[model samples]
Target chain A: MANNHAGLPSPTLGDLVLPKLYSLFGIANKDSLYGAVAEFEDGPQLVAAGAKVKEAGYTKLDALSPFPVHGIDDAIGVPRSILGFIVICIAFCGTFAAFLLMWYTGAYSGPQIPGCELVGLCSYPLVIGGKPLFHWVFGLPIMFELSILFAAFASVIGMFALNGLPRMHHPTFNYSGIHRATDDRFMLVVEASDPKFKAEETLELLRSLGAVHAELVEDK
Target chain B: MAGHHHDHAVDSYQLDPGKWSTGRNVLAFIALLSWALLGFGYFNDHERFFQSYLVAFCMGTFIILGATFFVYVQYLTGSAWSVPIRRILENIMVSIPIGALLFIPIAFAGVDDLYKWAKPEAISDALIQAKKAFLNVGGFRLRAGILFALWSIWAFAIWTSSTKQDKTKSIEQMKTSSRWAAPGLLVVCLTGCLAAFEWIMSLDPHWYSTIFGLYCMAGGCVAMWATVTLISLGFRSNGVLANTITVEHYHDLGKWMFALSVFWTYLAASQYLLIWYASIPEETIYYKERMHGSWAWVSVLLPIGRFVVPFALLVGRSAKRNLKVLRIAAIWILFMEFVDMYWMIMPNFHEYAHGFHLHWLDLAALGGVFSVYGLVFWSRFKSNSLVVEGDMRFEQGLHFHQV
Candidate 1:
């Protein structure tokens, strides 16, 4: 089984009889396909390899490494997204929330004052530096805090969303030799279904590009 | 720090011990003495720019002192990467005492010249009167003394340990700095903040902003980065650092320069927006002086020049990789930061219709500060290894390019 899988490029569409295989294997024509696994040593190397493979005209390829690699996105031709824009958006939300919450407390959520009948919401005058909601001096602190909280929280979410986590399945997991990715290993996987892929061609390409080894994986 | 390397230097990774001159003690004394006399003449000749001269001199001094405080902080944190560069900051901070000696006027002579509220007759205003306990000379000098003592100790720690390490090559000295780093930093920040309020911000007497300390801190950090940028460029241009300081190292430094510029702007804006939005007379008066007057051009240029100009120009590729371009951006940022400090400190006198304006003496005083700053730093470089070779992070910085 080990020798059978050794050094095979990610499969090309032409190498398989899709209709018969779909019937035999009971998969939909619109099914996802997993590819052969290649391993790497460190972040920069993985990022470099991912870039080269992408430049070789393959898409739908995925990379796994022991840690996140900088430029991995551009190396694999992914477009950049806005971490700052989202932070601004969240900040906007936070600022509004802080102001509104403060206003609500000042105008309606009246604190207990002895001999003051629970003043109706409308009866209470909103006063911060006598500016009302038109200008709330006291609320400026709240506004600043809100903006900071939102920006920080959004930054965390943005980072996590970009990384994509907690999934129980990945195609690379099927590559038994590739398990070292959890340790001091890095890997790039190209799908068999990519239009530019060919089993022998990709194997040759990866090996030529200085992969230590390459082997096919069956979809889980 | 990068320029200290030479290719014959490859064979000589060790510092050239000959550079530290015992013979030039007389010459060094002459240089410092001549500049001190020259600085006094320059200030005495231009009495009209008296307030400007004092504020500018004090600010320049505070910047060096504040930066020293920051370095002590990073040292106490056991920060490996910064150790290579901390000595330059220490050298600059040593100028603070020199500056403090220079600031004797604010201690006693400038009571009538600089402050309107300092007069006993002007104490009818209750708020100003209330702050009198703190605003008085005895109190002011007392606090000033305390601030100097705290900073001197922090600088003394690095200065003494570093020179000791130079002689003995003890790793434990590094560990000693690391252990006290955390607490020393806390004191530096605390004392540094009070110094800003008592020394600079409270010059207005009535106006107060809680964010003012942070405002000084952010500016201080940016100023320090600019000083480093200027030093790095000077070395590289002289062709002293052959393979030692490469484009990759510069790219890293430029990234930091870029990051600090933006952070300073963020802090400055945060403080400004808070004060502006509140619309309180006491708080808003701080901006009123600079925002509208002969200083108006500076007020306008500050936001546009300091932040927007650097942000747009540096947010590109060639600026960071090319040393000259990065230096230009750094120079511009430094220029804008100085302008911003001018905006903060100078406007109060003129804004109240006391009839003050910017003048050329400001430049001479600034020169005095820089001349002394440079002289100290150069002397320090002569004694210590220009780069910290024994630091554990030396290898990290070397491979900082490789990966």
Candidate 2:
């Protein structure tokens, strides 16, 4: 499907000349290059480019915009996040732990008081405020709070874990003009590792999709 | 981006009702058979008939009322994501009058059998006398009449104004509907509270929970979402609105169902925990009666079936987006909703019985009420666009995708 670049010529000798020269000189070899970075004026153009690349079956692609672009995830076919499920599971564990802890500390009495009857084996039941030993009502507030606490903890930690964030460096930073990605420009990166990525054809596709500036950035 | 060029013209998007005629006829036949069974139950076991009828009536009423609230809130929030399914909600609301009509049997014939306060002899008791002002048959019927009248008026106004905008395409109509919806919501909440108290909660006149109305409303919302999801899926499978109502919308609907199920559980637990902790006789009697026999199993099952199972299944994003998983969740929630209503109403009759008893009349009444309600909704839906094709935000909804 990537080869079906209609109304466009197949890559010729001129398209491969620059990479061949870079490899021969060893200044910035093809293997050391990151990918093609295309900068657009705004969100719409970036989303369009992302969609175009996705339709062309380019798997290793990323889009960065100053603000969140709606529908860009679908255009790029991003998988749904599993962070919510993880947080919920953590919250449930928190709730269970809180309930058990409350029961042990508040409900489970030590075998110190004489004539303290055990309801079950190892059960020294304490009647606090004339309530049952394991009253769920009294434990509800603690359960709720602990659930929220764990969910908040999981949300932050899980986000970091899933995103593989806190990175100090990336190959994309090797591009001199890529700093605009965090500012007013929307940038799309079609990685060289993608099966469909031919440096010349990918750059041509990006430019045809209205990228204001498209260029290849070296990895090192 | 490529599929964004879909025809925005309203005419091309209208659903063909002819394809649904055979299904509607089959439903009509089943509904007629159920009504016949109800007639048989009425003659054979008047008390059980009334009990079953109350459950069915309240279930149908709440779905319609809940759908009305759903539509009002959508308008109030100016939600774009729901525009594709707004017509389905409106069509559900259009069944309110039919539900009101179905209430006629319960109002006149089943009153004495259903309500303890309806018996004149009960007036001799001091507590019953104290509640006479609100619980008498005259007052009960009058309150029900006013509530249904308000619901019918709001349903008509909202439904007509929305469908009218299909042709007029006027922003004023949208504004008018929003203006009406704001106050209509309050009326719904108020009437819903009072009606729930009169119809279901008052069965055990000595017991009262302030959150009973909210509990019913939460369950109603869940049921409403289930109904909408079921119908939308059916339509999609039949190639109606196949393109317009995509998995994105189903995922949202699934989220609503999951959220409301959680809310319902919260309210149910709050009500139970507060009563259990207080240990007040009046309050605890409700639970005491429910916990007596087979009813105890139901009390336990309510949390598990209604909240825990649905919550566990639907908490995942993929579960909501998967068609088969969603269908199972939707159907499960709907059945749990019926069990909820049954648990509330049927136990009042079996207060002294040792175990749970399933009466054939329960199915008969549910079938009768739902089928009749379904028929009304089908006709109303056929008369309107399956999607809100003419709404200004319709295009936005068609292209909506969750980020």
Candidate 3:
């Protein structure tokens, strides 16, 4: 029988301990100060804090949780997503592209074939099975497929572009405990750049709204 | 209240039959009078009467079938959002038996006049001779009878089981209903397709499209959704189910109606496009007949009225959420549904004519068929609980909202 710990490292007290050096990354400077972070145990408390901060006229605030909290977007006064409109416009382009492709290849002339004497491309009005040169019905399937293809592409690209995702670093990551945002905890970050943000006042407000811990986090 | 096994307040949502007695009586009277007028017209001019009767019969049967489809879908999807208004659907479905009864007149007298393939002399043609096995009067009647029987049985089974669950509150009953719905839906689809074939498609026996069944089903679902929206609005206005079936539910129903309109358009457009592209003489004849006459205007208007206008009006989220907008859209859709049925059936009658013909019999037949169907629906609706109050999911449905 194989041992359970065959390929594993043994647990040690050193692995469980927090770093003791307070200034290991050097003293925080003006450029590296990110914002204040507030942690809440659940969604409602985070939403409550976000609403209060929004009401106090803080514009640069975001709420994060392991899952989406219904009504929180409106509570935080986030603008409606415009990704749908972008996808629709791109989908129309897709339809147009499909139409043009079908027309040039089948109905209209394209680049000349090497052995053919036709000036522009494949012979125009080359009838197949007595079908018309450019029947819309013949083009509809391509048009439909391309439209869906373009829309899906636009949806993914537009979502990432609008969200400013794939960012290697964010201000929220300055807080050591912020990794909990992807787990059990809810977090709200009030950016230092927001005009209404007052470090002391914002921290106090978060605490009053049931934040388990509030602290000013410095960016690296 | 939390520990209470049952809530008595739920009973308040049940319909008060006495409340709408006067209205019911009036509808009943109008129905009787319309039937009398139709009978007289049928005897006076049998040919014209049959033409118009086919249109009305198609509309009524499709409406009932649409309701049956909705009920099965709700069970199949395990949707709680429709629980509050499910009873209204059941009531609408109960009209199927009445629809079958209405078909008796057409079965006995109108078949020969309405169906071109019903004539033995016409079968001498190669196309008719080839199709004689399926298009013959005997086969048509048998298929129609089977379709109606299947529809009635499934509709009754679903409705009875649902109402029974309201009293028992048995999760097992819910399971059983879901079990029945799987097979029930298959039967509905099959019979619905055959019904469309026997009732409408065979009117122009030479023309055929495999997509016709889906096109009819889409139209039926749209019509049913519109009717449901209108009735729900009426109930809200009259202070019945006002709390249980809220604006949220209406919004959901409006979305369904909007989606079905698009579906109906897709199917109709696909069928037309395929036939036009092929340009085969057999298939092209259908559009040729429809396009050359004043029916051409109707042919153009079908897409605009049925698809374009409704799509534009209902595309906005606020339009679906607003009661007044939803009501207008619903009424518009219902009118378009009538136009759709009219377009399908009326062209066969005026194939040789250059212009549209408006006959008094058309109105009489519409009024006759709808009034009787409405009477049956109203009676069934009045006798049932306006809301399924005992449904375990009813409270959840009442609070359902779009996030």
- What is every candidate's alpha-carbon RMSD to the true fold? 9.2, 9.0, 10.3
DockQ of all candidates, in order? 0.07, 0.20, 0.20
Q: Can you write out model 1's per-residue Cα lDDT over B79-150, one digit (the tens) per residue?
A: 544544555566676656665565665677665566656766666878878877777778877787777777
- Candidate 2 structure quality by residue, lDDT tens digits, A160-208: 9898665455667766677787889988898888889999999999999
Which residue runs of candidate 3 sit more than 4 Å off their true CA positions?
A1-33, A52-59, A109-125, B1-12, B350-353
lDDT tens readout by residue for model 2, B15-92: 576776866887899898999999999999888888888888899889888999999999999898999899999989
Ranking by DockQ: 2, 3, 1
Report the C-alpha displacement of residue B342, candidate 3, in angstroms: 1.4
Candidate 3 chain A least-lDDT 10 residues: A17-26
Best by lDDT: 2
Q: Would you list the rank order by TM-score, best first? A: 3, 2, 1
Judged by DockQ cut-offs, is candidate 1 incorrect, acceptable, medium or high?
incorrect
B139: Cα error in model 3, Å: 2.8
